[model samples]
Target: MSEIKDIAKFHIFSSAYFASAVNKNQYVTDGRKEIAFIGRSNVGKSSLINSLCGRRKLAYVSREPGKTRTINYYAIQSRRTVDEVEQRQDWYLVDLPGYGFAKTSQENKDNWSAFIDEYMRKSPGLTMIGLLVDLRHPGLPIDKKAYDWLKTVAPDLLIIGTKGDKLSRNELHKNLAQLKKLFPTNHAPIAYSSLT
Candidate 1:
């Protein structure tokens, strides 16, 4: 237990808060840095964020596609410096709902589109957008649409691939190659496993 505690001491701490709407006038007032996690529905964006934070239940995870219907804001505070107290840190994690769920109504889809557009365009503290993809099928049309749109709008972004444990070595190689061909210059797709 002591070893576990020692290990956790070095990590960045994160706590999430759910928000149904993006009303700048009445949201959190923390001036911390922010990063966004976004992808198509059922692409394991929640799972990926959970894995990165080393917390199984921190971010909501659901088997049903598009379960996250709202923009969840997380206040991520780094480990306190050498002699600091329990409070005061700088950073945040922003988890936007996954887009492109097929079964949803057109109205819902339109709402999500507009919400994402507004969030990406209007947020000032947002630093980077972590664009997630499923490793089994890296470059779908919807993924391309997101990539292109973010490129034109939020250029500071990172592309990551999830659900890699399902793929064999050869398939992973091939899929990565295809992704490289599809997105040659800007970003490289990283294989990630949330289950691990």
Candidate 2:
């Protein structure tokens, strides 16, 4: 696959906080394709999003895990040239609540789980799901469960391995190989780091 080196060259404009939804009823349904980002707490989901949008603080970076409790929606508008014609595309980048390692009550975790499950199962505009995992330690039990769930519910699922900067080049490659072996799907995890 070909990669676009300069994101700005594509004339893409991204709004960090277009909307937020705490429940299924509040999800934006204006017919825009939605890409949801999900992962364990403190796996750098928010940081990865900010980096992707080419912004320093587009998504809130909290020191503590589970700081994001709602489904945050970011609108990205892009203008592309195809066949000598200019075309515009708008989509929503969704940040789902992270799971695990939150110093919250069991009740709150259960509620978040329900909310995430509902959104994943019922959202009509959800086109893709990015499942983030830490490269230092990938394929934990929770990550495996999340991958299995997405495989059943969503057709387009991408595994993202975050915190690549923390590992050496050799370690990164080894861990990536391990991750690929564990997931064992056509969708291989992409190595990513906010620092890079």
Candidate 3:
């Protein structure tokens, strides 16, 4: 973790909006590593991405849910050490469409679900998945289903607990504990708050 932070701090990190893919054929596959972000509707997925990149409004934020209907890609450039040699690397940050309780048409929801499933199963460059969940409401049935799917298809998923700022310290800890219980042997949930 320290090494990664050092690399990020030392390198010039710049990201630009790449392409938005509505289908598998339209996805960018230029041989760059990809990290995907996914979550339920209005779970602050965009805000989390913006915060990670240290750029305000890099990912579009909306007051309404289900605004992102496609798989949005952002190209990233940075420098890192490889085998004791420093080199530049290009990667992508993929923002996948949200699931659960979206006030969209059933057809649209089904389309998004199929697209997300296909992308998860077929994207060769995919390296990691960031699964965001609101801390205040930790265990929705949709979240459980998503977790189970990822467990089978993409076991290298990182659970991110969003909206931590909305909870008190005790509540945050308790919710995090519950989250850990859901994925007991997996990596611990990352508590994230856009405010701090």
Candidate 4:
């Protein structure tokens, strides 16, 4: 298994206030390639984003499940030198709310479902969906459902197993094998240590 450091070249540029409960229409408009981060509640999705961007608090991390309730768009800009001119390419790091929480209100779940579905389906800049799973746990019912749902919607998908630091070498391999056997999908799952 190749290390995650070899594959993920991520940087955090800036966090945007596209929208909130106040104004849902104020979402990001800049045409940018986006890759969304998704997972079940308490799977460390925000922590993974923070680590990937080399920031400690770029995305909100919370103890409570389903802390994120909106579609967050982080602007990523890269410079390209062309003909003595500097060209900037825009991209986004999208964070979607975690799912499968039993305590969430019905209204909240319905709203988040609609928001996720709309964004995943309609966002023209969306490039891929990064599906996150806790390495310690096997796939749950909601995890399978989410994977299938994303596969149905997104053209590209990346499955990420979080909390690699907590597992031993053999444990990691065993857990990964279990995931492979259970999911049995085309998407490749990568191990990630957000604390690393």
Candidate 5:
């Protein structure tokens, strides 16, 4: 765990909250590259953002799903040293509102779906879409639908299996195999555990 933390701490020179938007006009459009994280309401999107940013509290995480109602953006930069000079790649990590929350009214659901669709279609800086799913239960019908739609909008799509540590090694292996069959990816989905 410490090793993972150490790597995250050292690799990212800067990772900070940048923007949050409920409307299209509010989105950040500074021409920075963006990699959006998306999934169901309970798929651990916030946790993965925190882990990836090396800050435990970077993104508000809740046991209850659907707490994030807005599209949140985090600006991040990774530094590297080459030939005694420094190089940095600046990017934004966009955390989209999770879908499949049944508590919301149909109107709210429709609005969110429309908003998300608009963002994906219009964001010129969006480079890739990272879709997360629970390793314990991969390829639910909802997830499959999301992936299918994402593939059309995103030139590059990455599928990650979260909560990997919750599964036994054998179970993880089996689930990963299942994930391979469910998604159209050249590689198998990588199982991720925030704690690891």
Candidate 6:
């Protein structure tokens, strides 16, 4: 769907911070599915997370960009229905450090790149990668690069256009269409407004 998921159809019943990993050894080893979020710095990764969990302060919302350095994991038990049966599915929501344009030293950025790459390449629990792009800036080279790389790694993907509320409905459609040209998918990207 090119809109936010229906709160009723796919909703988080319980979500709590599970672990923060700076390396593979520290990662949660339980066999639980993981869904990850990645995007540019100050792109609202934490805010979107809090919004998805329906909790205002679940994740720290920082004014400074790239405040998240480690891979933080949250345990989630969500409600869903497969066929005719309604069931609870447990998984991990992984928040990766944001890439591109943040107030950090070049050495630190390089370290982060290596660290994030290791997790993305090694995490067996990764079920899907959710790529968030700014709805207004559809042509950012960094975002397109991330999209291309992520699709090669994870077949299951969700592309989201953030800050939908900033644009008019007509403008949102126009922007989403442009984003399609760069990040192609079977379905149009979701215009996501965490505020809504």
Which candidate has the top score in lDDT? 5
Q: How well is each residue in 39-85 modelled by candidate 4, as lDDT tens digits? A: 99999988887776677777889999977877777765545555787
Q: How far is candidate 5 from the true structure (C-alpha RMSD, Å)?
A: 4.5
Q: In model 2, where do residues sit more than 4 Å from their true spots?
A: 1-11
Predictions in order: lDDT = 0.73, 0.83, 0.83, 0.74, 0.85, 0.82
Off by over 4 Å in 4: 1-24, 78-88, 184-187
The positional error of residue 145 in candidate 2, measured at the CA in angstroms, is 1.8
Model 6 per-residue lDDT tens digits across residues 104-158 = 7899989988888778788888766778898878789999888888777754677
Candidate 1 positional error at 148, Å: 0.9
TM-score of 5: 0.91
Displacement of the residue 4 alpha carbon in candidate 1, Å: 26
Model 6 misplaced regions, further than 4 Å: 1-9, 81-85
Tens-place lDDT per residue, model 2, 1-196, is: 1112222246666565899998778989899888889999999999988887889888999998889999999998877787999877777889999998658999999899889889988898887788898999886999998888878886477778999899999999999998888876556678999888
C-alpha lDDT (0 to 100) for residue 7 of candidate 5: 29
Better of 1 and 6 by lDDT: 6
Give residue 12's error in model 2 in angstroms: 3.0
> What is the clash count of model 4?
0
Residue 126's lDDT in candidate 5 = 84
TM accuracy, model 6: 0.89
Superior by lDDT: candidate 4 or candidate 6: 6
Off by over 4 Å in 1: 1-10, 18-29, 80-89
- Which candidate leads in TM-score? 5
- Locate the minimum summed-lDDT window of 10 residues in model 4: 1-10
Write candidate 3's Cα lDDT for 1-196 as tens digits.
2222233444547888899998889988888878888999899999987887778989999988888888999888877677888888778889998898557789988878888889988998887788899999898888988888888776367889999999999999999999998755346787999888
Q: Mark the 10 consecutive residues where model 2 has the least summed lDDT.
A: 1-10
